[model samples]
Target: MKIATYNVNGVNGRLPVLLRWLDEAAPDIVCLQELKAPQEKFPEQAITDAGYNAIWHGQKSWNGVAILSRGLEIEEVMRGLPGDEEDTQSRYIEAKIAGLRVGCLYLPNGNPAPGPKLDYKMGWFERLKAHSAELLQLDEPVVLTGDYNVMPTELDVYKPERWVDDALFRPEVREAFHSLVAQGWTDAIRKLYPDQKIYTFWDYFRNAYGRDAGLRIDHFLLSPHLDKRLLAAGVNREVRGWEKTSDHAPVWIELTAGG
Candidate 1:
């Protein structure tokens, strides 16, 4: 089965581009982030017509997440991340599709760091780590996939030194990401192509895409059982170049069935 994750930026604004990619890629299941729309505003019919059933958690003009499954019923697992009752951002959604448990998330983009935003980001990371630890106990074929908004290592960014002050690449954030992985989750893309300069996001400014000034922020973390089934993984980098496309491209992983 092929499963993918994409941060659509805005589902309504980029529906056409998304539909095109869906037709072209035909992933069995997809986890989407950054819907940037209210619950009533989600273009459900358009997505349904594209041959997928979906469940989404949307907020007004900001963070949102969804899961779409082709030719299968999506059993809702949860809507938001646990451990923060006061946190109301629609950044997480989980579901069971095609025998796999999938968690889709759009982690906070804590820019202009050394402030409250960075604090929130770190706190969220801690919450996610606690929640992930619980999920690990399930020992099922699971995938935690989404735009983590983190450049995990020096190789994950185009210029590591230049992004030192950036929240996404800060040492604390990177260490948090590493600590999450150390909880027995495998970074699918990096595991598949360790030495390659793979990237999934690029800034729209300064001709970043043309210069390949990108970051590998989106990720798929597989449970040990699922990792064994991983057959292939990669970024659909060309999707970033399409007209009116999102800054993030799609990242995908193919797995053998019944692992």
Candidate 2:
């Protein structure tokens, strides 16, 4: 089976591009981030017409996430990160589909370091760590995939020195991501292409994509069992060149059956 993740940026504005990609790639399951729409605004019919059943968590003009499955029942597990009750951003959604536990998340961007945004980012990371430990204890095949908003290593960034102080590449943020993976999750893409420089996102300004200046922020972290089933992984790089497409390209992984 194939699973993919994409940050649509704005589901409504990019609906055409999204449908086109869905038609071309035909992944069995897809995780979408950055819907940037309210709950009622989700284009359910349009997505349904594309032959997928979906469940989504949406917030107005900001973060959102969804899971879509083709020809499989999507049994929703949860909608938000479990650690905080006061936290209400639509950044996470988990579901059980085809015997796999899938988590789709849009982690906080936490821009402008030395401020509250960075603080919130760290706090969210801590919550994620706590919740992730519980998931690990279940000993199930779990795939946590999405736009994490942090580049875990210099290797994941196009220009490490230029982004050293930026929120996404700050030393602490990278450490947090590293520590999270230390909890026994395999970074799937990195596992497959150890030394390769594969990127999933590119900036709109400065001709980032044209110049191949990009960041590998979208990822798939598989539980030990799922890691063993991993067969192939790659980015739909050409999709990034599509007109009005998101800054993020679709990233996917194929797994052996019977997980």
Candidate 3:
């Protein structure tokens, strides 16, 4: 099965691009982030017409997440991450599809660090760590896939020194990512192409995409069982060049039917 993740930025505004990609890529399962729409505003019919069933958690003009499955029912697992009752952002959503437990997340950007935003980012990371530990004990095929908003290592960024002060590349953020992967979750893309300079996101400013100045922030972390099924992984870099497209391109992994 082919599983993919994309940060659509705004589902309504980019529906055409999304549909076109869906037709072209035809992934069996897709996780989308950054819906930027209210619950009532989601274009359910349009998505349904594209040959997929979906479940989404929408928030007004900000964070949101969804999972779409082609020719299959997506059983809702949960909405929103555990460990924070006061947190109301629609940034995390979980579902079961194709015998895998999938968690889609849009982690906080936390720009202009050394402040409250950074604190919240770190706090959220801790919560995710705690919950990830619990998921690890399940002994089932699991995939944590989404726009992580983190550069796991210098290898993931165009220029390591250039993002020294950036929240996404800060030591603490990378450390948090390390802590999660240390739990035996396999980063599918990195594991597939360890030495290649692969990237999934580029800034619109400074002609970053044209210059190939990008970062690998979106990811697919497979639990041990699922990792064994990973067959191929790559970034659809051309999607980022589409007209009115999002800053992020789609990242995907192909998995064998059974482990």
lDDT per residue for candidate 3 within 67-172, as digits (tens), equals 9999988999999999999999998999888789999999999888989999999999999989888889997899999999999999999989999999999999
The TM-score of candidate 3 is: 0.99
lDDT of 3 at 105: 93
lDDT of 2: 0.94
Q: Decide which is better by lDDT, 1 or 3.
A: 3
Give the TM-scores of the predictions, in the order they appear. Answer: 0.99, 0.99, 0.99
Off by over 4 Å in 1: none
C-alpha RMSD of candidate 3: 0.7
Stretches off by above 4 angstroms in model 2 are none
lDDT of all predictions: 0.94, 0.94, 0.94
lDDT of 2 at 54: 93
Write candidate 2's Cα lDDT for 1-259 as tens digits. 9999999999999999999999999999999999999999999999999999999999999999999999899999999998889999999999999889999999999999968999999999998888888889986799999999999888899979999889999989999999999999999999999999999999999999999999999999999888779999999999999999999999999999963
Q: Summarize candidate 1's per-residue lDDT along 117-210 as a digit string, tens digits.
A: 9998999899999989988999578899999999998889998999999999999999999999999999999998988899999999999999
